[model samples]
Target: MANIKIITDSTCDLSSAIVKELNIAIVPLYVVFKDVSYRDGVDITAAELYSKVNKLKELPKTSAPSPKDFHEVFKPYIDNGDDILYIGLSSRLSSTIQNAKIAANEFPEGRIKIIDSFNLSTGIGLLVLMAADFVKEGLTLKEIFARIQESLPKVKTSFVINTLEYLHKGGRCSAIQSFVGGMLKIKPIVQVVDGRMILGHKTRGKIEKSLRSLIELTMKDKDRIDLKRIIITHSEADEEAKLLKKGLEEALSPKSIIITSAGCVISSHCGPKTVGIIYLTK
Candidate 1:
């Protein structure tokens, strides 16, 4: 058995099969709509979350898993006498990491190390996958922590909001301004910088162009890329994701490219038709 266990929250946006295949533990977040709460990626799905958003004309609130939720996932590993390394969603975006810390503090001198990924979606997922590699390599917990920390600065995460409606509805931008952007066919790209989301280049006309912009930016440092793998995460943006996958294959020549749909926690904010290209640099 591996000496260390890997855990993450749903905001990682990793596909269920990959998570299960890697034997990674994921504690889900919550998506609440009209007084009803559903566990992200469990009771609720991205399609259901998007359906409610468009149908209700409002954003569903997403909450981090409680301390008890963390305990349930952690206790099993602790009982098995395994060390844990949890890669959490950006604290700037969610309080999932904080709750995990609280739960860890209550354990009997538990051996849990939590790293704030300082990123979102596939951004954090990339880090978790790397940790899984470390475990498979028979690396110690201390070594995995050092390597992940060393890799933090080189991880790049970015996405484009196909429409401004979701951002504006969440008060991230403005509804009126987003309506104007829609009228003008403005698609803005967002990048995670120091754990916060910031606007990047804005594309006009098509989402294909926006996706191209993301690929171009990622390839800006092509020579520095660790093109072993990459992630094309989206919220029902399959066509654009395909375009990105093709582009990455042609441009960066990555070995593995994964496409995963966002769950309720992410779809609650990014809405439908959002796509992000996440990668790591050497």
Candidate 2:
């Protein structure tokens, strides 16, 4: 078996348990509130993050891990004689992958490979797990890199915002738009297309309707879904996420459905009750 290490950033939204079990090294991003900063998922928890936001009445700013941060995480594994595969947040969304590349350059060539996931939350997590699986199968680093690149475009990521408050606070939408959307109970669907967030459909009435809309949209690709795994990730919306999970179970019947809470970085933007579906297509 080849000696290898899998690494990802905290924006991936994977649980610590899974990270520990897989032995994946995670370099944390930063969540800044005024002059104070905390490492996403390391120095902060989702509940605490939400509480701080509510108390401050503003969304916190998120930052990518620095090149130095990546170096610290990479050094131990390299010293142990292990090659590394780092699946990171999208270059379009943040400079995290760029920083990882800078850190990789400090090491010998071919010892590390960096992949731009072009995704966030569980979308990136899905790719990280896929790379880990390839490693466990004893695939060579070269072969695993090719497989990951092929699978990159197959990742499907979309989510529904339960409230427009956070979006407005973060300047994503204007106050008037937030007011009108709130009055009508309109939930906006955000889709990850070409490595950027684009507004998709808007569902009215209740949050449940939007959640159902997500399931319906996903079912359109049922025939092509990889079916190996599906992830439903939420920011303080466990019950709503469970509803979506049940609906997905009856409709798609995928082999595995995992539920994870979004980390501080994702939660800071999406706000409470935001839920997203992430999966791969064959």
Candidate 3:
């Protein structure tokens, strides 16, 4: 049995294959549309959520799992005599991390450790993966925490939102901004900075130019790129994701790049046609 167990929520947006391969435990969040609610990843998948989001007249809403949810997921590992390390979405974006911390406090001392990733989607997933790797390498809990802390500032994420309607709906931006931006066909380039989402730049001309700008921002520090570890996540925008990947490869020529779909929770906030780039820097 492993001495330490790694846990994360569905917001990580990691694939089942990767989770299984890494032997990591994931707790699911909930997505609600009107009176209907479903557990993320368990009751509904990215594909299903995407289809629903596209067809529904109103945008879907999402909620973080409660303390009870984290308690249930953590009990088994604790009962098995294994210490648990739970990583979660950014506190700036969700209360999931706070709930996980509360749940951890309910347990006996030294039994659980909850980490706020200060990131979202594959950005958070990248940090979770790094923690999992450290645990798999037989590192102590303290060592694992230290490594994650060190990598926090080095994790660079940048994205381009195809439309600002969802951002407006979520009250992250004004409706007038969305209206004017949408009319102009402006693509907003955003990034995760200091644990909160911030607008980095706006590309007004064309999609290609916007994409190029995103790639350039991500590859700004060519000397510090961690090529072997990078992730690109998109919300029903495979073509743009692919084009961004190719552009980044040609520019920085990273060691590897893994592309995957962003989950419903993230998609709910960013809306469809959102493309993100995540990388670990030295």
Candidate 4:
């Protein structure tokens, strides 16, 4: 059997250390600012992207990688006779997976398998980590793929945003909604549902208060949450992310709670001071 290699896009929000340790390959998306495009994670860090946004007072446009970009990432592994298991960004959210499908057509059939995570950030990262473990246990590529599909719906992915301005800029929110929400200091807890982001609920208060509400909401289903690993992803919200990790720790005492910074592609839409909690369920 050919070795199975796991590949995921940069939007997984996994730490560079974790990616290197797991031997996971990442194909980055693009972050475009005023006609200048930089590969997410490769050319622009989230901090730099935020800096640019703050300076220009304009949100950058994010884009999926082209089919050619995916092709290049897939080619070397194909030549090595390894089987590829690519877990990508949600199909409903971006064309990253679709482009990956287009690239797969350039390679021999049966060697490449593309899966839509139907989730983003460390939500996708959780699935990729599971696939990596499956590979370690000597499972076939097909087995890993099947297991990932089974695990998709069990992922609980959600975030609380500090402001709606980014949503308005991205056209996900109406200007009036943004203006009103901003004035009210309304924070929305956006949940991933059926591969699309759905407004879960709204909390009216300071961000810290909203984060506490988010923790309460997440812990409601704690009994069903898989304790193996949990992820806290943030965009320029280190302290807030740490608070989330601490809350989960005190409540669930999960085996692993990883804090990773969201990359440019994710940060571009959610904007600064956004934090999300991601995990798989039992």
Candidate 5:
């Protein structure tokens, strides 16, 4: 092995068990509400954030981890003489990767490598796991980097927003538009395209209809899917996510399916009841 250490941001939506099992390090971002700041995964959790949002009737603002924060996380690894690989959320979505780059410059040139996952939630988690797999194969840093770079474009990150309240509050849509959409129960399918969230299809009626529409869209080109692994992630949406998982299991029959909750960063933006299926396509 190459004495490698893997680091990722809290937006990866990976569980504590998996992070510990993989021996991965996570640098947390910040979620600020009512002038109080909480570390993404450390101080705040998805359910707590959502409860506050509903109680306060406002969405929290999220900030990327500072370069100094990354330095703190990188220090122990560098002192141990281990080469560090930090996979971060999209530069376009948040400045997490850019800040990591700034922190990496504080150390020796080849000691740290920062990868912009160009993804969020478990989509980034999948990429982190992929890198860990390559590490177990005894690949050098150079080889691992090459493999990761190649796999970046294949990572699919997306979600179905159960409500547009946050979107309207964020001014992504007009109040009247949101009011009308909410009245009609219009759920928008949102996906990461070129590192930013874009509204995809508008599915009307109940949330279940939108989820089925999402599954249909996912399996429309089922033949091209890798089917090796799939992730279903949500924000305060256990039953809805499991329903999506049920359909996906019947359709793709992936080798493994992982379900997890969105972390502070993801939950801050998407609000509650946001669910999505993330997978790689061949």
Candidate 6:
């Protein structure tokens, strides 16, 4: 058995199968609609969240897990004599990272390490996957921590939102402006830079151009890519994601490519047709 255990929150957006295979523990965030609340991946799913968003009068709101929630999730393994490494969503975007840190302090005598991934969704998922691989290879908790810290900046993520309506509804963009842009069918290509989302380029014609732009950016270092570990994640847009995957494979010809749904926590913000790519670089 691995001496160290990996833990992360639902915001990481990793699938249940991968989590189980990696022996990773996930603490769920909360999603509230009207008067009802549900645990992120437990009671709410990406498809369900998008369905509700389409029918509801108002957009649903998301809440980060509290320190108590983190404590509850951590106590199990820590008490069982496993060293814990709690990787979390970006500190810039949510207080979840801070909450995890607070909970880690609560067990001062136990071996627990909380790390702010400085990323969200599949961005964090990619990092957690790398950390899990290291742990499975029998690396010590300290070595795994050092590996994650060294690799954080080398991971690149870029995405394209089919429409800005979701960002507007979530208060990440101006409603009136995004609404107007959506009517024009403008697709925005965005990238995660310095731990925050920023606009990269925009096209008024098709999502294909936006997707092409993402690939071009990723393939800029085509001669030296470690293609064995490329990942693609989307928000309820499997068709588009499939198309993007096909295009990426033909272009880069990576050794492996992983495609999965971005969890409800991110889908809640990016909405239904967001597509993204994550890759590890030298």
RMSD (Cα, Å) of candidate 1?
1.4
- The number of the candidate with the highest TM-score is 4
**Superposition error at 47 for model 1 (Å):** 0.5
Supply candidate 1's per-residue lDDT for 213.
Answer: 84
The CA root-mean-square deviation of candidate 2, after full C-alpha superposition on the true structure, stands at: 1.0
Model 4: per-residue Cα lDDT at residue 3: 91
Residue range 112-231, candidate 2, lDDT tens digits: 999998888889999999999998899988889899999899999999998889888888889998999999998999888877777789999888989899998899899999889999
The number of the candidate with the highest lDDT is: 4
Residues 1-282, model 3: lDDT tens digits: 448989999988888888899898988888998879988888987678767866886667788899999999999889889998888899988899989998899889877877788888887789888888787688988788878877888888888998888898778898889899989998898899988999879998667788888887876877888887789998888998899889888887777788988877888788888898899988
| Cα lDDT of model 6 by residue, 71-171, tens digit | 99888887888899888888888889989988899885548877788788877888899888887788888888888988888778888888788888888
lDDT of 1 at 274: 91
Kindly report which residue pairs in candidate 1 clash with one another.
none
TM-score of each: 0.96, 0.98, 0.95, 0.98, 0.97, 0.95
Of 1 and 4, which scores higher on lDDT?
A: 4
lDDT of candidate 1 vs native? Answer: 0.87
Evaluation by TM-score, superior candidate among 1 and 4: 4
Superior candidate under lDDT, 2 versus 6: 2
Question: If the candidates were sorted by their lDDT against the true structure, best first, what order would they fall in?
Answer: 4, 2, 5, 1, 3, 6
lDDT comparing candidate 6 with the true structure: 0.84
Residues 50-129, model 5: lDDT tens digits: 88888998888889999999999999989988999888898888889999999999999888988888888887999998
Runs in model 5 deviating more than 4 A are none
Candidate 4 per-residue lDDT over residues 1-282, each given as its tens digit: 999989999999999999999999999999899999999999999999989988998998889999999999999999999999999999999999999999998898899999999999988999999998999999999999999999999999989999898999989989999999999999999999999999878999888898898899899888999888899999999999999999899999999998999999989889889999998888
Q: Candidate 2: list runs displaced more than 4 Å.
A: none
Candidate 4 lDDT score at position 54: 87
Candidate 1 vs candidate 6: the TM-score winner is 1
**Clash count, candidate 4:** 0
